[model samples]
Target: MPDFADLRERMIRRQIELRGIADPRILEAFRAVPREAFVSASYAEAAYEDRPLPIEAGQTISQPYIVALMIEAAEIGRGDRVLEVGAGSGYAAAVMSRMADTVIGIERQHNLVQVARERLDRLDFSNVIIIEGDGTRGCPEEAPFDAILAAASGSHVPKPLVDQLAPGGRLVMPIGNPNWVQHLVKVTKAEDGRLQQSDLGEVRFVPLIGEEGWRDG
Candidate 1:
């Protein structure tokens, strides 16, 4: 078996510390989560390598730095309800569950949803809810989330996600043209429903697929 604890320390140093991610809450979540369990058995050894690795459903898990960055950008707090799009492998959602009171994750692939559900269940993370649907639309039934994170990249921010953001809520995602580079964006919605956008940095993510997003061909 691989030394997961040792790998976790290395990941914190190389991916979280060296990358300028200064949020202590985000760091703690990264440290608490076992990333190896979220990846495939074949790639378990490389789970902490600061690189994106293939997961089930033809999707790749985001790099640890990117995950931490996005979570930090969201500025999650204890007792906050969060919505996560593209719940690949359920790893990111699991991390968020630790920081937030509740987490709802949506994935377009049914198989990925199943895998994510099983993974979270096995880990005894009861605070996460995984659904199979078009994440671009967001989860209206559970609207007014305290924070929202999108794991995939889209040409623009989805309107539904913005609508679901609670007052003083934050939404973080990669936005840009698909098949090209994207910018990691952080959006904050005020009580009046106006959104303020900030650019975090450049990032690459799988294209988001949905009616308002890139259509998968």
Candidate 2:
């Protein structure tokens, strides 16, 4: 059997921590969740690598560094409710579940939804829920979320997501052409209702598909 624990430690030290992801909570969450369980059996041996790995529904789980970066950027707290767009394999949601009070994952693919739900359930992450729907629409019924993270790249930040953010909430997502490099942007809703935006860094992700995102080709 592969020494997944050792690989995970090395990944955290080289890929995440050295890259400046210093949040103790985020680091601990990564350590708690087994990335190997999130990927397919075929890819289990490579789970702790720095690169993103393929999952069902043609989706790719975000790299560990990227996931940690987004979570740290959002500044999720124990009392906050987090909504994850493009839940993918539910790995990111599981990580956030450790830090946030509740995590609602919106995934567009039906197969992925089932897989994510099963994984979360089996792992006993009772605070996480995976639902199937158009992620771009945001989870209106569950809003307003304290922190929102979108794993896919959209042309712009969906207005609905911004509207669903609670006062003082933060949203982290990638914005730009999907085929090209995208800017990881963070939007914060100020107490007075104004939106403040900042760029985290460059990243590449699949196109976010839905009414408010890129249209299906």
Per-residue alpha-carbon lDDT of model 2 for 3-31, expressed as tens digits?
Answer: 99999999989999999988899899999
Model 1, residue 132: distance off in Å is: 0.7
TM-score of candidate 1 versus the correct structure, residues matched by position: 0.97
Provide the global lDDT of candidate 2 against the true structure: 0.95
TM-score of each: 0.97, 0.99
Taken over the whole model, the C-alpha lDDT of each candidate is 0.92, 0.95
> Which ten contiguous residues of candidate 2 have the minimum total lDDT?
21-30
Please, what are the lDDT tens digits per residue for candidate 1 over residues 1-217?
8899998988898879888987788878888789999999999999999799999988899999889988888989999999999998999999998899999999999888999899899989999999999999999998889999999999899999998999999999999887788999999999888889999988999999998799888
